[model samples]
Target: MQAMENGGDLPRRIGVYTVERELGAGGMGTVYLARSRGGRAVAVKVARPELAADPHFRARFRAEVEAARRVGGFHTAPVVDADPDAQAPWLATAYIPGPTLAELIERQGTMNKEQLRSLGAALAEALQAVHACGLVHRDLKPGNIIMADDGPRVLDFGIARAVESTRLTATGAAFGTPGYLAPEQAQGDEVGAAADVFALGAVLVAAAGGSAFGTGTPMGLMYRSVHEPADLSALPGELRSLVASCLSKDPAGRPTPETLLGSLGPDPNPSPDPKTLALATADRPHVAPPVPVEPPADHGRVDEPLRRAPAELSRTPRVMILLIAAAAVASALVGGFLALTRHGDDNKGGGPSVTASDSRRATSQASTPPSTPASSRVAAAPKDRVTVVVTAKSGRSWISAKDHNGQILFDGVLDNGETKNFTDKSQITLVLGDASLLQLVVNGKEVPNDFQPGQVERLTYDRSGEMY
Candidate 1:
């Protein structure tokens, strides 16, 4: 989970809830932090335009919404409300405030054996409820698991089913994150409850600081998941066998969620007090924000070879070979954006491609300065004003900027080579979906940042032109 930021085009109200601010955006649609009429906080997910436009998708969404609402368990965030028949389909869930498992691992390193067991048990229990409700959490990566005070909470259950058989998947593009995908999913085969177990195993491997299969290109990862073995060397010895079974290539061989819960034993650490959880959250420094990225529309074209796989394997099936070829092509076409999207960053709509001409124009503009000097430009502006110029230097990025009063100034995807400017009297809050994809000039000078690729960032700049 990332810090919420203001978006200019945010709806004032969705159904009975008043939208407060944008929590995040992803392939499915933008998610907002809103409050019910009674002042209860909830997270509302609005479907993307393309998706909502499809009648078939909407039917699936409606059914999935009903199924998701039936899912009940302490480990899952319950769905609060939904209106699939609305102009744009939307679903609301009880808001759980906490950092995601991905953020935790990135900040605090790998969890110990005790922590691993607790997380695994909790998630397995959550899956039980989902499966019992006749649904599967097709996508169960680290980003979808929130570490709340009480325990881990699973999110977006049954939602991925709404995306299945849609135009995107019809073209052979597999949904879900590549690294955590099961072999059945990678091959476009029927996915069942066992697929979630496979993903659970992969997520556990990731939490242990080990890539189940060594990472490379998305296609490479999928190929490996299908044909190779997971590297469990970094996993704790006690739990390696359990995790290994979950990552089994054959779904029938994978353990059920019930089996997983029983095998994980008892939770070693009980949930902490609410006060302790609040204090811990307050003590952490503000870091990069995370927005969800939906699966790319053009993701499964086959063009690139599996760089890490053998050139020719006798055991490779013909159907899988064809699927790999298609995936390679799609990956080659949109690898840069899909790479981040696949990892759960905010690139909903997959964004527009940056052409060669756009790159050349951007390079020319960057290399050439304006006629006015930086000092002169700063001097010319009002004393109590701040100006920010954001340019999509390398690729497209979702950007949201707001004024001190929380008025949104700009909100949308900034395509490569495109630029947007905003001025605020006292302060300007900016949220970049992928900080490394853009260049920022505040006041008259270029703002420097060390943000990594696909890293979402939230920054505030005052009249002094200093970022806080």
Candidate 2:
């Protein structure tokens, strides 16, 4: 149901709920924050226009919604209402305000060991509940898990399948995110509970550190999932073996959700106190503000003249003094900015590092040049600062460029013909989508690129123009 508004397009109502605002949108549809007639807050996911017109998709959606309703409320958000037959089908669930796991990690960084364990255990339990209802959550990833004040809540079973279904599955379709998809899923094989477990393993790795398979094109990630072992080197020693088991290439070898739950052991971070829990439940927080980037501190040079240099010095050659002062100020600003952008500082030496000890191993990689080739290396310049420029040539691409300090210099889509520049003193990491569509220039030298469209690529560079 759509209620007309006075001006531009606005959906005042959807079914019985009054639309408040859009929470988010995805391939399937947009989810709106709405209030029921009874004054209860809810999240209403309205199907996309095209999806609503597809009878097959509507049937699947309706079945999934019914299954979602059957999911136990213990570790999952319960479906409150839905209307699949409506003009634009929609489903509503109790609104819980919190950041999704993906959002949390992006803003607050990776979770501690105990936090990761809690997350894994909670998700496994949720899957157990979901599976007990004879449903397999075919799509389980960080974006689908909400870190509520009470505990983690699993969400979005939009593509869940009933265990007893005999219809041919659409395994070949690129339905889920690449890195998180199971090997079987990537191969277009029948996905079962083990598939969810595989996704769980990927999620745990992402929560604890970063993507286990690393970033690449979806097809590349899929190939890795089918052929290579998960990289759990970043996981704590205590969890390596267990997480490894969950990521086993063979479905039969993977642990069931119930077994995985037991393996998580005791909660490392216990629940809040009764009073705290009461308060949390009584008045829930709606959203968590993104972590703020620390702005560069003022060097106080902007007012240095007022503090130092006596008034009598003002009689000196004004132009000469001004030129000298300006040069000094410029040099100081550039150096400070470079130092602040160094990535390894705030990490306190915790992340992957390209140290002297690993230089031999790094150089041994045949595909990646340990150092810029003599033919490709940038000519020696006056300053040692590293510089990078990316120009989108034929197609739009997504980009995330970060300095050593983990500060995002740019993170968004880049349209064709657009260009972006970045600089850093120590190192910079770039995550690029459709790498083939962009030309890369490092320190004024162009690097050879044969990347293809729709592929993801991650590149790290140091001040010396060395690739890591």
Candidate 3:
């Protein structure tokens, strides 16, 4: 299960989705609740920056995403998008609309015999689909199961092997939750489909009652899984036999998901109502994080004035000082008279006379050109500047952007996490080499577009206009 964390610093855009916030992070990477360009909500799982550097890890992660994509079953969260070769490889899946089984059990207590039966059947069916795709859901603990409206749905199938093979076992230790790992997995043996069945059995025990092996240190749990018999006394009378068969020490003795479904008979409950499930799974009330306090601005360092005091005033004799003051006064009077004459001539006809304007222009050209006025400089600065942040997630993509006036702002290759922010007035248009490789953000909102891999796209957006 991914550990929940405050997602305060999570990027506003990842891939093509706008990240709402982080849901959690495990040994693998952070999971974010994000929305697609088409307004579809999805759970985006991103690999950690460090892990993305490992070539072996990237290969395994890509394989996991591909394998998960091939599995077709209503019982699993379907992969909506993915880019494993990205700087921070990520996968997006349809957001399940319910709480995890673990959360459900924690809040409402264990499921009754009937609920357990339904859950067992659904998960087994999901496993069948996974195995058929030549993959194994290495991590199938209660946390990975969501009790959706229709039934239980499995999640996090993408990159399961990457997490198991790289992050968790980096210290030469085994991966997976100790209590839920199959005996074969704990023994460091190569796993097969039956390994998932063993995990399902453990899940059943928790659903029917609680952890069968109880709690202990990692080593203790590993010891019990390999040597001790599971304490299954709390399991309901009817499910004990089937659950035990699944928890058998030998993998061959375990029942496949299909066989387990048959053993459970039939689904007894109608699909849960979507509205009810949504309400039940609504985010729990949480204390809003305290607003950060900003440091006070420094006001002591003032800019030096451009003009300097006349040094001659301090050193000149008293007589010379009076002479200098008189001379300065005379010069100011003459300058003011000249300014009045120019202004009167300029306003003779309620507008500047052509001769006056020409004379002013000639004077201006005769001296060094006046510095650009602050007002004019501000106008010259970009306006309606739509900041477009483009990040490359996979292979290199040709990225070019233009302002509403058709002026190109950016033209270059972008690859995995490589980002460029552009500013323009009115609107911005983007031309992408491959839709899937580029994630777009204009101003602060994510641009919605489902550009297929290797497909070129030309999209335009404005401050007030929707992306097109």
Number of clashing residue pairs in every model?
10, 4, 1
What is the lDDT, from 0 to 100, of the residue 169 in candidate 3?
A: 21
Compared with the true structure, what per-residue lDDT tens digits does model 1 show for residues 282-333?
Answer: 7665733333343322112222223312233223221121111222434332
Across 59-168, the per-residue lDDT of candidate 3 in tens digits comes to 88888888888988979999989987777888899998788998898899988767788788889999999999989887788888888989999987645567655423
Q: List CA RMSD, all candidates.
A: 20.2, 18.6, 30.1
TM-score of 2: 0.56
The estimated TM-scores of all candidates read 0.58, 0.56, 0.54
Assess each prediction's global lDDT (C-alpha) against the native. Answer: 0.69, 0.64, 0.61
lDDT of 2 by residue, 276-330 (tens): 6667666656743334343332111112111223332233111111111222544
Q: Model 3, poorest ten-residue lDDT window?
A: 335-344
TM-score of 1: 0.58
Top candidate (lDDT): 1
**TM-score leaderboard ranking:** 1, 2, 3
How many clashing pairs does model 1 include? 10
